[model samples]
Target: MNLFINKCSKLHETQFNLETIHSLYLTREKIYGLNKYIENNIG
Candidate 1:
């Protein structure tokens, strides 16, 4: 029972990390796309 709980917590931590990284990646892509749009439209 103890080992199962530990494993479950570890899996949750890993999933949280992936979500954090994915959001960061999405934010960066959004910024990059906005920059491109500004450059193309303004220039």
Candidate 2:
């Protein structure tokens, strides 16, 4: 029982980390695209 709980906790932590990284990557991509669009239109 204790071992199972420990394993579940570890898995949850890993999942949270992965989700956070994915969200950051997506945000960066969006920002990059928006910057490019602005530069193209302005210049």
Per-residue lDDT of model 1, residues 1-43, tens digit only: 9999999999999999999999999999999999999999996
lDDT tens readout by residue for model 2, 1-43: 9999999999999999999999999999999999999999995
Clashing pairs in 2: none
RMSD of each: 0.8, 0.7
TM-score of 2: 0.92
Alpha-carbon lDDT, every model: 0.99, 0.98
Q: In model 1, how large is the Cα lDDT of residue 4?
A: 100
Per lDDT, the best of the predicted structures is 1
Candidate 1: count the clashes: 0
